[model samples]
Every structure is written in C-alpha cells, then in structure tokens.
Target chain A: MDYFLELLIGGLTRGSIYALIALGYTMVYGIIELINFAHGEIYMIGAFTALIVAGVLAMSGMSGLSVLILASVVAVIYSAAYGFTVEKVAYKPLRHASRLSPLISAIGMSIFLQNYVLVAQTSDFLPFPNLLPDLPFLANYVGFIGSTEFIIIGTTAVIMVLLTLLIKFTRMGKAMRATAQDRNMAMLVGVNVNRVISNTFIIGSALAAIGGVLIASHVGRINFYIGFLAGIKAFTAAVLGGIGSIPGAVLGALVLGCTESFATGYVSSDYEDVFAFVLLIVILIIKPSGLLGHKPTQKV
Target chain B: MSTLNYTKYMEGMKQAVVVSLWFMFLTFPIMVIRVNTIENIIEWRWMNMLYIGAGSFILSFVWRKMSGRGISARKESIGAQGGRKFYLQRLVSEKRLSLPALGIVAVIALFFPFVSSIYQTNIMTTALMYVVLGLGLNIVVGQAGLLNLGYVAFYAAGAYTYALLYHHFGVGFWLALPLGALAATVLGVLLALPVLRLQGDYLAIVTLGFGEITRLVLENWNEFSYGPSGISGIPRPGLFGMEMDMHEATVYLYFLMILLCIITIFVVNRLQDSRIGRALLALREDEIACQAMGINKTMVKLTAFALGSTWAGLVGVIFAAKTTFVNPASFTFLESAMILSIVVLGGTGSIIGIIIGALLLILLPEYLRAFGDYRMLLFGIIMVIMMIFRPQGIVTGVRKTYEFHTEEK
Candidate 1:
C-alpha cells in the first residue's frame, strides 16, 4: 500500500510537469490551428538555458538562493524570447498560407533546432545541480511521505494556482482569451492579436521552461535530445485533455503522468511509452475532441 | 524569389551569363577529370557539377519552368480550374515510352556484365531496395494521403521476421519475404484500427511513437531479439539450389531484384486503376466527402496501411538477404523520415516522379561520401524550399491511373 501510494504520488508529480508543457502546445494549437511541432524544442531550449545559467553561476561561486533565482529568471526570459522568435520566423509567414505549409515548416524548424543543439552540445548529457531550498519539512512530512512526489505535486499546484490567477484576472490574460475566441473580432475590439499570440507563446514557453528546470534538476541529467519524448508526452497530455483548454490540459497531464508512472512501476519500463500513446489512441478513438475538449460543430 | 525581376534587360543578361557560366562550370570539371575514367565519375568537383549544378539546380529549374509552361498551356487546354489536372496529363503523355526499344537495349546490355564493377553493382542493388520501399510508401502517402513517419518499423518487422524464422527453421528467402510482409500487414491493420481517425500531425505523432515503441521493444526484448547485439550471419538467397558465392558478379541477385521491381510496378499500377485505388484517392482528397460518397473510410485506410507496410516488409526481407544480418539499428525514425522525404520530394501521387525522387535522393547520399554529415542539413533546407515554391511536388503534373480511377463525389 505504501509503494502504491508512493507510485501514485510520483505519477502526479510527473503529470504536473507534463501539464505545464501541454498548456503551451494546447494554447498555440488553439489560436493558430497549427500544431507547433517545435513547441517541444522550445521546452528544450528552456532546460538548456537553465543548465547554462546554473552551470555559469556555480562556476562563478554563486551557489545558494541567489544562484537559483538567477537561473530561473534566465530560463524563463530565454525560453519566452525563443518562443516569440519561433512564432515570428517559422509560423507567422505561413499564417495566411495553406494549413499544411506551417505544419511542414514547424516540423522543419523542429528538426533544425534539434540538430543545431545536437551539433552545439555534442550530444552529451550534463548533470543539473539542485537549487531547491532543502527545507527540513521535506524530511518531516513531504519527503517522509514521499519526497519527489510531494515536491512535484506541491510545485505543480502552486504553479497551476498562480497560472489560474494570472489568466483569469490579468489584462494580458483577457487579451489572450479574446484573441483565441476570434482574432478578427478581438482585433476590432482593439486587442493586438499579434501581441496576444506572441504573449501566449511567451507565457506557454515560460511554464514549459519551469517544467524543464524542475525535470532536469530532479532527473540530474540533461541532453540536447531530452525534450523530444517529454515534449511529445506533454502534447499527448494536451490532446488527451482536449487541446486549448488549460485546466483540461493540466488534468490530462496528471492522468497521463500517473499512468506512465504506474506502468513503469508495474509493467515493464520498456513498455511505458506504449501506455501514453495507446491511451492517446484510445481517447482519440473514444472521443476525438479529447476528455475535456468540446466537439467543434461545422456549419457547412 | 521575386528578385528575378531585376529589370527585364538585366534578367535577359543574367540568363545569358548564367547559361555561359553553366557551360563553363560543366566543362571545367569534365576537362580536369578527362585524363582518368574513375576521376571523371568519382572526383568531388565533377560529382558536384553533376549533383548541384546539373542535378538539383538544373532539375529544379526545368521542373519550375515546365510547371510554369504547364500552368499556361493548361489555361489554353482547358479552364483555369483544370490547369493542374491538364498539365499532369500532358506531362504523362509526353513521358510515354517506346518500351520495345528500351527492352532491346536492356537485352543487349545483359551481355556486357563483365565490364561493370562490383562497387557499382552494390550501389545499384541498394538503390533498387530503396526504390521498392519508396514505391510501397507511395501507396500510403501519395494514394491514401496518410503520412507515415515510422515506416522503418514495418521494415524492421519484416527483416526480423525473416531473421527469426530463417535462422530457426531454415526458411528460404522467397518464403520469408511474404511471411514477413504478412506479419507487418497484421501490425498495420492493428495500428490502423486505433489511429485511423487521426488527421495529419496527430497521426504523425502516433506513428512516430509507434515506430519508437517497436525500436524500444527490439532494443530491450533480449530473449527474443538478442537485444541490441542483433542477429547475424543470415544466409544470402541462392538461385534454384545453386550457390552464387563461387559465381563471378552478383548478377543473379540483381536480376531477381529487378524482377521484384517489375512485379511491384505492375501491382501498384494495376491497383492504381482499380476501384480500391479510387476509394483511397477519395480518402486522400477529403474524408467527409469519401464517407458521403459511400466509401468505408476505415476499411480503405486500413487496407492502405496494410499494403504500404507490406511493401516495407518486402523490402526489409530483401535488406536482410543483402546484409545477411538483422537488427534494430537499421530501422529508426530517421529512416522513416527519409522515406517520407522521397515521397514528398517526388510528387505525392505520381509513380514516375516517386521513382526518380527515390533514385536521385537515395543514390546521391550513397555516392557522395564527403557531404555525408551535411546531407541531412541540406535535405531540411531543400524541404523548406520545396514546400515554399512547389508545394505540389516536383514532377507533380505527371499522369496517373488515378485519373480514370476517380470515385464519384
């Protein structure tokens, strides 16, 4: 029972990270109607950025809270910028072009970024130092109950609540919703559609960056190609949650994360990937719109 | 791209200059390598002139220009809506062949096998294998409009099928090929049942996962697959109980491969003209429309996946025979991507286009050893360019039996 509880907790932790990344995929897909295949790469950029920031700070003898704060900020800013540029260069031009144009372009960009990193980083795995505050409470309750699990769940909840507040109340958040609903109408209402889209990429990418930092730090190893599988799983989570719905994406992420966690714990680890994909296929077969996704009714 | 409008007089001057430059570029290398036979063919500069200056640039230009002419001529032939359709038909008719003449040439060339080198023969064989794989995938992507990013999984499945069976039971090449294809077909149908409803990128992601899963399974399933170490020493195909090791030149195997190619072409061409092909085309053009037209989208799509995978399986058997080994390394996501590139690089629905696309792209990588690392980079750039200018595909206007095979909307 303890091991089962532990597995359950572990699953939710991974799921929360997936939920964050899924939000990015779901948001971009919602507004543009194009699968941002490179979204995963953006998540990758965040982790790599955090790695550099942490590595550089440690190298310069900055070790504690200051190093943590500096690394986190750098990761968020760098990821957001990368996301914005990716939208501008890869996706913006094909906005008016045929639907397939942007998709193919995104795939191309994804391959390019992956290869670029592969060349730049020499395909080696780097260790990420933990910058988390080693609170005694982890040992007393969280870690005593389950360490990684509680950290994941607690961090994810905090992030999710913060995200919920930001989207529901903030001015930029309102703009994003308006843009997603109808670009033309939103533009007429004086919403800067381009700004909103860019902001969405930035916001989504920032969350994914946070997820990346946590994951790499937790796993203690990072590499150029690490984001591919994580990115795909998150996208699956987004899809399973009914893409474009943030809360749904997060819920889906948790479910998927836990499912894989359990599968790895019980079934063969070799077959863990098969669970998420098979679930995706199953969900798609059962409800094409996803778990919380609305069915789009065609007028014609 | 519109920078070509640099004043008509300047454009005219540029064309003349380019034509002159092309001649000079073509001659300089040939002139330099004239002293040696191997140098003329194998020298880097000479090959570049042939690959970049001649093969890619010239071919791209010709196709672009032809498409331009086709667009205009199509306007003259029919209405603007039929422009694409008309151009392709005209292109196909123009490509109509005098097979008897080629057949005589082929018969005559069979006598001169002693002159061809072993390295050239091996290259030819590899090209043949890819052509088979490319054509098989063409059925799914070109005819059915289903993008398979994990085609190599099926290929791997077939190769493994042959390896496990032949090594264990001493099954012959001819028997293993079909059996391997059958196994892949079963997997394809099973995969299709779940993934058929997915469109485009969702489908791509699922297929990608599917391929990865197969690879992971192969990598980890040590008891059955021997894990990453792979199965080795699988025997080569013998001709009618005669061993070919003592025979000079792998002439018999080449002939067998050519025969396979002929059969593939015949089957695919026949299928293209059949009712089933029309249904697959309907699914490609629009799923809703196909359903409205009374086509069973699921069955047709499953058939497509099965057939396409079956082809890959067949090619894998050949691959196993040639390599005399089987492993997970030979089948990867990148391999699937490469096959998909061939289909895209060629016009999706055109057989001749796919054939040329497969031959040129697949062979270029093998023959040019220096540009190996940068090949993938260049391939990505080319894909971007192809998507931008000729989203339809090179040689896209070629005739297809699909014209006569169109189902009612």
Candidate 2:
C-alpha cells in the first residue's frame, strides 16, 4: 500500500509536468492545426533560461525561493518570446501554402532551435540548482511525497485552474475559441485571427516554461536534448487525451504519467519510453479521435 | 526622386535596426551569457551581442530584398504564359543536352575511384547511398505525400536483419542482402497495416513513435542486438570467392553503390510514370478525390510504403557491409531527417534535384571542414527558406501534359 501510494504521487508529479507541456501542444493544434514541432524546443529553452537565471542569482547569494520566483518569471518571458518568434518566422508565411509546408517548416524550426542552443551553449548536461526548498510541514511525508513533488502538484493545480478560467471567461479566450472553430468565420465576425494565434502560442509557451522550471529543479539536470523526448511524450499525452481538447490533454497526461510510472515501477525501467510510445500507437489504432476528441468530418 | 529614394533607404535601415535589436535581446541569455552552476561563476560574452546585432542587421536587409523580389517574381510568373521552366528542368528535358551530360557524368563516375584517394572513394560511396535513400523517400513523401518520419526504422530493420543473420548463421552478404530487404518489406507492410488509416500529422507522429520504440527495444534487448555495444567485424561484399585488400574492397563497394543507385533511379523513374505512379501523385494531391475516382487508397499507400522501404532496406545492408559494423546509433532520427532534407532540398519529386541535393549536402560538409558544425543549422534554415520561397525545390519536377489534334481531312 505504501509503495502504491508512492507510485501514485510520483505519477501525479510527472503527469503535472506533462500536462504543462501538453497544453501548449493541444492549444497550438487546436488553433492552427499544425503540431508546432518547435514547442519542445521552447520548453527546453525555458529550462535553460531558468537555469542561467538561477545560477547567476545563486552565485550572487540570493535566497532559494526568491531565486526560483525570479528565474521562473524570466523563463516564462523568454519562452513566450521564442514561441511567438518561431510562429512568426516559420508558420505565418506558410499559412496559405500546402499542408506539408508548415509542418516541414516547423520541423526545420525545431532543428534550428536545437542546434542554436547547442551552438550557443555547451552541449554537455548542466546541473540544475535545486530551487525548491524543503518544507517543514511536508517532512513527515518524505517517503511517499517529497516537498518538491508536493509543490509541483500544488503549483500545477493552481495553474490549471487559472488556465481554465482564462479559457472559459476571458475575451482573448473567446477569440481563441472562435478562431479555432473557423478562421474565416472568426475573421468575418471581427476577431483578429493572427493576434489570437500569437496569443495562443504565448500562453502555451508560458505554461511550458513553468513546466520546464519545475521539472528541471525536480530532476537536477538540464540538457538541450531533454526537450525532444519530453516533447514527444507530452505530444503523446495530448493525443491520448484527444488533441484540441483542453481537459482531455490534462486527463491524457495524467493517464500516461500513471501508466509510465506503474510500468516502469513494476517492470524494468529500460523500456519506459517504449511503453509510452507503444501506448500511443495502441491508443491511435484503437481510437484515432482520442479519448475526448470529436471525430472530424471530411469535407470535399 | 533622389529624396524619395533616400527616405525609403532610411526607413529600411530603421526597420533593420529594430530587427537587430530584437534579435540581440532574444539571444541575450543563451548566446551572451554562460553560467556555471557548480562553480558559481558567470561568463558574460558581451562580444556575442555585437556579432548577433551586426549579423541580424545584415540578414534583415537581405531578407527584405529577397522577399520583395519573391513577391514580384511570383506575380510575373503568374502573368507569364505557360509559366517559366527551371533551367535544370529544361536541361534534363532536352535530350540533345542531357545525353552528353549523362555521358560526361558516367565517365567521371567510372574514373572517380582511380583518380581519387580511397578516402574520397568512401565519401562518394556514402553520397551515392544518400542519393538512393533520398530517391526512395521521394517516392513516399514526394509522390505519395505521406510523411513517414520513421523511415529510418526500416533502415535499422534491414541492417539488424543482416547483422543478426551473419552473427547467428554465418550468412554471407550475398544472401543477407536480399533477405535483409525482404525483412524490411515485411516490417513495412506490418507497420502500414495499422497506420494506413492515418493521414498527415497523425501519421507522422505515429511513425515517429514506432521509430523510437524500435530503437529503444534494440537498445534494451541485449542478447539479441548486443545492447548498443553493437555488432562489428561483418565482412564486406565478395566477388567470385576472391579475397581482396582494403583499397580493392573500397573500390568494389563504390562500384556496387553506383550500380545500385542506377538501378534505383531506373526503377523509381519507371515507377513515377506508371499507373501506380500517377495514383501515388493523385493520392498526394487529394486522397478523398482519388478514392472517389475509384483508386484503391489502401493498396496504393501500402505499395508506396513497401516500395520506399525496399530501397532503405537495400541501403541498410550496404551500410552494414561498408562499415563492417551495425549499431542502433547509426540508424537515428537524424539520419531520417537528413534523407528527408535531401528530398525536400533537391525538389520533392525531382530525381535530378535529389541527386544534386544529396551530393551537395553530403559532400559539402566533408569538403568544408570549417563549416562542419554549422551543416545541420544550414540544413534547417534551408528547409524553412525553401518551403517559404520555393517549395518546388531547386529542380522542379515537370508534369506530363497531353495534347490532342483533330485529323484535317
């Protein structure tokens, strides 16, 4: 029972991070219908930015909590900037082109960003400073739930609620939904489609950045290549939940996280990634529309 | 008029400055600052900011000019009758020029091994392998419009099949070659069975997942795949049971690749004009319309997948023979990307374009050692720029058009 509880908490923590990244993918896909392949790169850049900020602040003798706050803020800003730039440079021009054009461009942008980081920063993995300080209240639950895991889950829950409100009640959110439903109709109805798309990228990127900071602090390591695998897994989570659906992305992420956690825990860790991919393949084969995604009718 | 021109120039310069400033800000943390967390030290490379500022300033100007020209050129092309033919396309279409060009190329290829060092011969062999791989992928992505991101999985399948066959049963290259391709074909069919219903991005991600699964399984399955330590010491291809030295073997492999490349080109060219070829093209353009026209979508997609994998499988065997080694590392997503870039850069459906793309991409990095690190960066940039400016590629594929004339009696 104790082991089960531990695995459950671990899965939730993992699921929260995946949810953060998956939101970006799902939202982008909802609006533009492109996979936004560079999104993982955005998450990676976010982590790197936080690492840099945290490292500098730590060296200057700032306290842990303050450093974490400042680092997270800067990471969010930088990631949002990058996400906006990537869409503008890569996707905006190819909007009128064939379906494959934007996808290829997105892939190109992903590669470019990865190489950009590799060239600019050292390719070796850097140690991410543990910015999450230990909470005295959580000391009794150390075995089953660490302070980092507690905070991660807490922060994620708060963010998810905030995101839900933003989407459900906000004007920009309404604009985003309108654009996603039909770009031309939204334009006719006086919604600035481009602005909505850009805002979606920004919001999604900000969420991913928060996820990046949390995961980096939790894992204690950072690398340029971290984004590729994480991105794929998050994408799987999104697909599992049914892409283009918000709550579905969260549910899918949690399910995927739990599955990975249990699979790796009971079985061997060697096939952890394989389990995720296999699950993805299985889900895709069984339910192409995803758990919550509606079946898209083909138009002539 | 001079005042107006000066004002325009000044406006452009102002925009360039803003663009450069934005770039400098964007690149500040990553490019200009390096923080050592363990050592608690900060290295601020202020010079990088200057470089980025200058680079972006110049690049923005170039970007504006190019885009301006692109819009006008597109308008002109649209206005022109019958559209403007690419020079390379014309060169290929005219037999008078193409035959001699082909003869010259053939002569150069035949004499290349003798004149060049063994190192150059090996490099050329690698380039030729890419040519075949590019052409093969062109069939699926170019003609059929199905993006198979896991194309390297089949390559890995072919390689591992040969490696395992040789490892377990002492199978020779001659036997393993056909067997490896056959194994890859079977895997392709199997993969296609599940993924045939998927289209576009969904298909891409599923294939990508499939690829990752294959690699992970290979990496973990120690007893079977040697668990990433890799299988080495595979023998090279043989000729009439004769033993050859290193240089002789290199030459042999080079010639073998050339022969295989020719055969692949021939088959792909013939396939492109065949009924199935037209079907693949139609599928790429419009899947629903094609099915509505009575074409079997499943069989066509399956054929494209199978045919494409066959070439990858063939090359995988050759790759194992050439390196005398087999490892999961050799068959990576990057390899698939490189091949896809070759197809995209060369012109998706254009054979001549792919050949040029392969040679330029593979050989340029080797020859230009100083820019080796930037090769992939350039490739990414090229892909984006090509898609934006000229999606048709360097050599556009010419479509066959028919004309009818009534008999005047």
Q: Which ten residues in a row have the lowest lDDT in candidate 1 chain A?
A: A141-150
Per prediction, the TM-score for chain B is 0.74, 0.95
Q: What are the runs in model 2 whose C-alpha is more than 4 Å off?
A: A140-143, B81-83, B406-409
Segments of candidate 1 deviating more than 4 angstroms: A96-101, A145-152, A169-175, A178-194, A298-300, B1-93, B96-124, B196-202, B246-255, B364-373, B397-409
Question: What tens digits encode model 2's per-residue C-alpha lDDT throughout B14-90?
Answer: 98999999999999999989997667779999999999999999999998898898788777868994467667877
Compare the candidates by DockQ and give the number of the best one. 2
**Considering summed lDDT, which 10 consecutive residues are worst modelled in model 2 chain B?**
B81-90
TM-score of each: 0.79, 0.97
Classified by CAPRI criteria, candidate 2 counts as medium
DockQ of 2: 0.70
Per-residue lDDT over A47-127 for candidate 1, one digit per residue giving the tens place of the 0 to 100 score: 777776676566556788898788888888877877886786567655665555566666667776676556444466766
> In order, what lDDT does every prediction score?
0.75, 0.90
Native-referenced Cα lDDT, model 1: 0.75
By TM-score, the best candidate is: 2
Judge candidate 2 at residue B208 and give its lDDT. Answer: 86
Reference-based lDDT, residue A11, model 2: 90
Candidate 2: Cα lDDT at B49:
99
